[model samples]
Target: MRLSPGARERLTIFWMLFPTFLVIVGFYIYPTLYNLELSFTDITLLKLRKGGDWVGLANYWEFLRSSSFFDIALNTVFWLTAVSVTCRMILGLLFALLLNASFLKRMKLSTLARLILLVPWATPPVVAVIAWRWMFDPTHGAINSWLLSTGLISDPIAFVSNLSTVWPAINTIIVWNTTPLVAISLLAALQTVPQELNEAASIDGATKFQEFRFITLPYLIPTLSVLTLMSVIWTFNNFVYVWLATGAGPGTFTNVLATEVYLKAFVDLRIGYSAAIGVTMAVVMALFGALYFRLFGVGDMQEKVG
Candidate 1:
C-alpha cells in the first residue's frame, strides 16, 4: 500500500530518528528502569553474582530513616543555593557587564583579561581540586606561606582538614571553576541586547545603573532564568570537587546527597540503597525542572536562544 505525502514524510523522519531513539532507550531508559528495580530489592556487591530477593521499598525506607539523611539533604540544598546564586548568577553578571562595557573594548589587555579569567573553568575538575588541596595545605601551602610572609597570620590555617573550613574551601574551588562559564554565557546574552536601547536610556539622562536596570536587565531576564535553573541542577548533582577534595569526611560535615550516594554505593557496597538515593535525586531534579518550565515558560528560552 502507498502512503500519502504527509505520512511518508513522518515515516522518513521516524527512520532518521530511529537510531537516536534506540540509543536513548538502551543507555538511559533501560538503566534507569533497572536501577529503580534494584532500589526495591536488597541487592549488594555480594549478591551481584547471585540474584537477590525483592524486598520492596526496603532500601528507600532504610535511607529515609537513617540519621544522616536530613543533614545530607540540608547540605545538598545549601551547596546548590549558595554556589548557583553567588558564582553563577551574581558574580557572573558582574563579570559579564565588565567585559561587555564599551570602555573595556578599547583596552589592549581586555582579551588577555578574559582568557585569564577562563583558565580556572578550562582546567580539569580533578586537577583543579588537587591544586587547590595543595594550596590549602596547613604546613607548607602557598597560601599559608604567603600569608605568613606578609604578616597576615602567625600560624597556618588548616583549610580542608577543619570542619568549619572544609565546606567553604570546597565551595571556593567550585565557584572559581564554574564562574567563567556563567560569565561567558551571560556575555553572549549581553551582546544580543540592542545598542539602541542603552543609547536611548542614556539620552534620557539615565545613570549607568538606571540604564542597565531599564534596558539591559529586561533583555537578560529570560537568559538569566534558564541559566539559573541549569546552574542549580549542575551544582546539586556535582560529585567531583566534594568527593576528591574531602571525600565527604571530617565527620559528615560536608556530605551532600551526591557524596552520600557515592559512599553508600562503593564504600559501603550497598548498591540497592545507593540506587534509592539516585532515584530520589532524579525525582527532585525533575520536579524542579518542571516547576521552572511552568513558572517561566520554556518558549521564552527557546526564543532567546534563536
Candidate 2:
C-alpha cells in the first residue's frame, strides 16, 4: 500500500522534527552509552585525568558485596511504597473526588483550592526541601514553637535529625509536593464522569458509599493505576528530599538508591560502583513499573469482560 498525499505531507512534517530527534540522540542516547561503557571500566576522576583500564564486572561485584546496598534498597522500597502508594496516589484520588463534587463544581471554589494545592508543586523541590527542613528543626522551628506554645510536648522533637523519623519526614515533604500533580490528573478524569450516573444512583435510593463504590471507583481505577506506577518511579528516584533533608544520614536510614548513587559516585569517587547501583535502581523501577501495568491491565480486562 502506498501512502496518500495527505499522509506524505504529514510524513514531511514529521521529518522536519529530525533535528530534535538528533539532539535527543546526541545528548541523551550518546551519554547513556558512554555511561554504560564507563561502568565497565576502572573510571575515576584521577583515571579520567590520566586515562583508565578495563575492569570487567569488578565494580558490580564490589557493589553487590557492599553493606549499604541492602539498606539503600530497603529505603528505596519504603520511599516508593509509603510516599507513592499511600500518600501520592491514594490522597490524590481522595482529594480529586472531593474537588469533583457537584457543589464544588458549581461554586468554582475547586479552582481556588487546586491553585493553592499546587504551591508545593510550583515551587522548586530544593526550596521546598529546605523550607521543610527548617520547619522540622528541633528548636525555634515553627512546628516546635507551635507545639510548645500549645503544650503538645515538653521538648522539641528531632524530626529530621532522628533516623527513625527521617523516612516519614522526608516522605511527608515529597507527598506534599508531588500529590498535586496526581490530584490534577485524577481530577480531570473525574470531571469527565457523567453527573447523570450519580443522580440516577441517588434517585434509586443508593447511598453515597454505594454510588462511589460502583460508579466512581470503576472509572478511576485505570487512571489511578497509571498515576500510581508513575508515582512509584518518581518517588523511587527522589533524591532531593533525602539529600537536602538528612544528607543520607543518621548513618543509613534515609539513604535511598538515588541518594546512595550520588554519594557513591560523587562523594566516594566510585564511578563504576555507582553506575552499578544506578543500573540496579533502573532495573528495580522498570520491573515495578511493568508489574504495575500488567496487574492493572489484567484487572481492567477482567472488569471489561464481566
Candidate 3:
C-alpha cells in the first residue's frame, strides 16, 4: 500500500533507530531486569546450573543486617567524598587555573604542563596502582626512604598495611590517577570564558580573586556542576584502584561498596546478595543524581564541551 509523506518519514525514522533500540533493550534493559530478578532469589555458585527459588526481600534484609554494612557504607562515602570527588575538584580547578594563566600561554608552558599532568591518566590503571603500592611499602620504598633521609620520620611507615594510613594511601593513588582528566576537562571549560569579561572586571578595580570569583567562576558553574556529578558517579563506581592496591585492606578498614560487591559475588559466591548490593548502589546513585539536578538546574553543559 502507498503511504502519505508523513507516514513514510515516520517509518524511515523508526527503521533508522530500530537497531540502536534493540541493542539498548538487549544489553541494558534485559540485564538490569535480570539482575533485579536475581536479587530476589537465593542464587549461589552451586545453583548456577539449576535455578534457585525466589526469596523475596531476604537478600536485601541480609545485606542491611550484615555487620560490615555500616562500615562499608561509611568507607564508600569517604572514598567518594574525601578521596575522589572533592580532591579532584580542588586540584583540578587549581591546575586548570594555573595552566590557563596568560604567562603560561605566552611562554608556551601550558602545553608542556598539560602533557605532564596527563601522564598519570594516560598510564594503565593497574600498572599505576602497582607502582603506587610499591612506593607505599614500609621497607625499600622511595617515599619512606626519602622521609627517613630528610629527617621527616624516625622510621618507615607501613602505609598500606596500617588501618590508619591504608585509606589515605590508596586514596592518594586514586586522586593522582583521576585528577588529570578532571583538570583537562576544566581547562577546556576555562578556555570558553571570555577574556573580555575578565579584562573588564580587572579594569573595574577588581582584584585577581574578585575577578575570578565574579567573572570566571560564574561562567564555569555549569561545566563544574556536570563534571562534579560525573566525577562522583565514576569515583563511587571505581573498583580497580581499591581492589588492586590493597585488596580491600589489611582488614576491612578500606573496604568500600564496590569491593564488597566483588568479594560477595566472586569470593564468597553469594550471587543474590551481591546483586542486592549492586541494586542498592544503583538506587543511591539515582537518588543523588536527581538531587544534584534539582540543586544545579541541569545547565547546558554540552555547549561547554571542548
Q: In lDDT terms, which candidate is top?
A: 3
lDDT of 1 by residue, 1-306 (tens): 999999999999999999999999999999999999989888888889886679898888888899998889888887645554566688889999988877888876679879987999999999999999999998879999999999999989999888777878988888888888888888988998899887888888999999888888998887788788888888888899888989897778889889998998898988888999999999999998889887877786677556
Clash pairs (backbone) in predicted model 1: none
lDDT score of model 2?
A: 0.80
Misplaced by over 4 Å in model 2 are 1-21, 105-108, 298-306
For residue 47, give model 2's deviation from the true position in Å.
1.8
- Mind giving the per-residue lDDT tens digits that candidate 3 earns over 1-306? 999999999999999999999999999999999999999998987789998789999999999999999989988987645567888899999999998988988998988999999999998999999998888888989999999999999989999888778878887888898889888888988998889987888888899999889888988787788888888888888899889988887777778999999999999998988999999999999999889776655454444443
What candidate 1 gets wrong by more than 4 Å, as runs, is none
Model 2 residue 255 distance off true place after TM-score fit, in angstroms: 0.6
Score residue 272 of candidate 3 by CA lDDT.
88
Candidates' C-alpha lDDT: 0.86, 0.80, 0.87
Using all chains and alpha carbons, the TM-scores for the candidates as numbered come to 0.95, 0.88, 0.95
Give the higher-lDDT candidate: 1 or 3.
3
Ranking by lDDT: 3, 1, 2
Candidate 2: Cα lDDT at 241: 77
